[model samples]
Target: MTFKAAKEFNTPVGNYCYYHISRETYPIGITQIKEGNSVYIMATPEKALCDLIANQPGINLRYKKEALEFLEENLRFDMDKFCQFNPEIFLAYAKNGKKSTSILTILKLLQHE
Candidate 1:
């Protein structure tokens, strides 16, 4: 899934897919992964978590406890790896969204732990 500046058309199918279009730099969070002859650029776990929360429309993360619960239970993120996550790309993606604060809050919590 390549990042495009403009939104593209996708036919409805049983499988769900998302294409993030932005005027800013693309793949704000990504790493290259190779499997056999194929090479793919995909979001790191940190970016994936950020995108998931950011893309949601009206999720509430105002409370630290609730936010932590969501991350641990709903998202099932590995807290251990979170300490190694880089926020640069997630920040870029979250810059325009209301969820940026929540993302930062989570990151801050993870870092302090």
Candidate 2:
């Protein structure tokens, strides 16, 4: 995923695979997992959710209500697990990623909950 806005493309590999191109440095939470001879680099749950919010088009969450609606109604996210996410990761993403206002709104929503 990328911090900068660019054309989004999908690779046809059974399930569609989308990739983001980055032009600047940004904070990301990732983990490397190894199984036998294979290693996989994956984004943490916090980072994945942040990336989804930041990268998705037409998402302009500027208030707690909007953020909450998107999370609960649109995404059907489990509110029980919402509070478990690391706030610091969202803060870091908000600092260096796109859609700062939306990201901050999410942070604020989390805090209020």
**Predicted model with the maximum TM-score:** 2
Candidate 2 local lDDT, 11-32, one digit each (tens): 5655443546354423466678
lDDT (C-alpha) at residue 58 in model 1: 75
lDDT per residue as tens, model 1, 1-113: 33444244555655545556454535567789999999988877776777677667776676678777897898786777766777666567667544777887776666663
Q: Which lDDT values do the candidates have, in the order given? A: 0.67, 0.79
Task: Give candidate 2's TM-score.
Answer: 0.79
Q: What is residue 109's positional error in candidate 1, in angstroms?
A: 1.0
- Cα deviation in Å at residue 13, candidate 2? 5.4
User: Candidate 1, TM-score vs. the true structure?
Assistant: 0.69
lDDT of residue 4 for candidate 2: 51
